[model samples]
Target: MEQNDHLGQARDVTEFPFGADFQSILSLIGDGVVSTDHTGRIILFNRAAEDIFGYTSDEVLGGSIDALVPTRFHDRHREDVDRFCSSNAPLRRFMGEGREVLGRRKNGEELSIEATLSRQMIGGQHIVTVVIRDVSARKTAERHRQLVASEVAHRLRNTMTVVNSIVTLSARRAASVIEFKEAVLGRFEAISRTNDALVSGSSTDVSFRLLLESELAPYRDDDSKITLTGPDIALDGQGAVALALVLHELATNAAKYGALSTSAGRLNVDWKVPVDAPPLLDVTWQERNGPLVAPPTRRGFGSELIARSLGVHGGTAISSYAASGVGCSIRLPLTGAPPLPQ
Candidate 1:
């Protein structure tokens, strides 16, 4: 994810810097230093090389340079080494051009690395020194960031499509322009609130209970009569957003004609996960103690959304206007495909 070529020259390992120790200086440098002969045999191995390649000096001192390179790149690595050794450049050649190199460790695991080669002609033998730094962690992190960016872009497009559908459906049910605008704005507000919660959450999956509570927050006094029960599991990103819209529609209808319209009304919402082989989420919405319930003569946008959204989410949604109250159940299969952004 990052590369740099700094200006500096390291002295020969055998040279004494103002009578200071020679090998001690090489051991103190942070980067791995490996010295190889013209035949591609490693003649010098520093402590950093051992730490990076997982080999002791005794094991790798005279080993082929290909020992550090992956098996697939062995041919190319040897050819490059030979070409560098035969080059008619200056006596000291400093190369710091960045490359995505890999090193093979003792355990056979490969890691990303950045290496700089220095070719020097000492006496009559040509020696090559390579400096290496491990970069696997940085690369992995960069890949994750890219994936997050791509996922965010796809989800934003999906959200806009859902918004367009909501606008069209809301317009169909309104008699006047003012009524149409109010219906659209209300649905948009519900969607906006869900998006806010999604941004505030630390993970992509949202807590089911928290989502429901936020949608039902408009009538805080109804909390005393409303009940919610089950293990609070999380929903995937699309599932969370779609369910928020579904719950908002149900609550709006309830305030107009169902349980929430009367003072004595009560509502019970619960969920169950069966002991079957592949357990699924079974959520129920029931209301009672309100005005007499009647089935809708015509399907509205609210009804269509509640009835069809779960099906798109790899699940089912069904409702009944029984003599006592209105009841609905949504079944979401956990092992199946995740909810689509429909």
Candidate 2:
């Protein structure tokens, strides 16, 4: 080891024994290699170190190693270095295995890095070497994984809440145990179908046409009885789930009492995207050729579910009991919908 006192008076490593081999070895190291004296002054700044810290070897040779560390860690860094140098242990020690430290580049950008420290007594001179590797990419990937996990947990909670509400409402509306069982099982099946559509697509949102098609699948045997008219619009998570529940309730009621209850009855569903700021989708559900309709004396679970679902998104569902049949006019705010010529 070449003995040099203080900064700026640092000597070229080539002047020391096997100095050429020492310099050659430092150049070939893939990770940043920084050697400092007992005083924490840098003595050897390698090529990899120059690339990692965004500094030329000449620029940092006589500088304090603290320059590479973020200001927040300066105190801890100094304490750790001092303790390591004072200890009698001669073996190398790994630093920041799972916990990483921040490294400051020449451009002032911060990086996540892991470091390994080793001390050697060469010719009675204590030389401390630190090998650093950039781990910013790994840290970023870990954070992304955590975020996805959190989102999945949140979605699962919301799904459970919706299922519980369905159970409570189904029991409240049914007169017999068989009726309750059918209602609950049917609604659960609808949710499962909706989830299937959600995952089948590559996108997070589902197509408006697809959402409606899934609920109206059983009635599609007679195309003349079911007329669906609208440009395909995509619905986000909240919108997709809300509209699915609303559609299932409407279809159920129609099958039990309205259009789908009679062969002569017909169901027509049409929607249009109106040209307006904060776009809106105007939909009409009209039943024709069924028994004369009359408003119910009391609202049922279906009515309550439709109203609540639409209300969450500042939308409205108005049921009309015309003598011809049952009809509903729904107005909903649609986000990120492409405006089509109406």
Candidate 3:
């Protein structure tokens, strides 16, 4: 009798501490924790499990764990429980173990959940413990990040379109060895600037007034030769780059053979965005008081650059050789700027 009494005391001491440890560990978990018997009946539901599934522990303790599973999974879940009970196979019980599943809330709203399940023997019976966490917010954030990355990539491609045009046209216009070298060098420099801007992941749209001033800076030595007037508007990276190259090519030509070739010439640039046109931006470049004006007998680099830039957006340009001066009018559809690197 004494030996049996001592053995009983030892068992009680071991079991009591073990139960306390198990409860302590379960209480610390943030996710829902549930234990089911070999017959798939719930035996334990932690406080977090009650909060997560919107069921009181008393209501779930003697019920089937299937109450938390979606109706669509009921049949397969029974098969799985049977297999697990028979084989006592080790089931994964961590974040990456189970296929993504939906858990139904008490309010009938469905939530995306990740589950980890494990099996153990308790009181001579096999039981399954499941830990579940809601992953909806994490999934949402991942999708949002992917969408932003895709948009940025699309914008960068659009910006490249303008860069490609500038390089092609500028290289084609080089007649003299020196002229060709300068054009190639200028194209490279422009591409470098574009790459620098893209690295920041900023939206590619830039203030139009700022772009114009920056592009026209090369001609600032004779600041009196050029005049600019316009309200500040933003252009997408592609539009800004295209317009900048067009202006650069025009300025280069004028300095070599057009208005800027002589002291008596001046260039005027102006823009207007009318509300009736919604998003359309209208701009004009006018050359005045230059030497005798005449259209090039053959289409040159300046002509090609302007035509291609406008052509991409179904735009139109009219170059006129009036008695007073040469005037070029370009009309482009002002669609919201294409995605491109800032």
Candidate with top lDDT is: 2
Alpha carbon lDDT of residue 158, candidate 1? Answer: 69
Instruction: Give lDDT tens digits, candidate 3, residues 1-342.
Output: 764464344334324546878777877889888877676767677778777878887676656767887888888888876766675555654533446677877776677878877887555667687888878788778888897788669766876776666666666677777887788677556545544444453554666666566666766667688898877766665665566666666666767767777788888989877668756678887888888877678987768777887677666677887756777776666667532234
Task: List runs of model 2 lying over 4 Å from the truth.
Answer: 1-18, 22-30, 37-100, 104-109, 119-127, 200-204, 222-236, 260-284, 289-291, 311-315, 331-342
Error of 2 at 257 (Å): 3.6
lDDT scores of the candidates, listed in order: 0.75, 0.81, 0.70
Identify the runs in model 1 with alpha carbons over 4 angstroms from their true place: 1-20, 90-99, 277-279, 335-342
Worst 10 residues of 3 by lDDT: 6-15
lDDT of 3: 0.70
Between candidates 1 and 2, the one scoring higher on lDDT is 2
- The parts of candidate 3 lying over 4 Å away from their true place are 1-24, 27-90, 93-115, 120-173, 221-227, 258-266, 289-292, 337-342
Query: How are the candidates ranked when ordered by lDDT, highest leading?
Result: 2, 1, 3
**TM-score between model 3 and native:** 0.64
Can you give the TM-score per candidate against the true fold? 0.83, 0.73, 0.64
Q: Model 1 misses residue 134 by how many Å?
A: 1.8
> Residues 239-337, candidate 2, lDDT per residue (tens digit)?
777788888988888888888888998999998887665687788999888777889999998898788778978999999999898899988898775
In the predicted model 3, the residue pairs found to clash are 155-339, 155-340
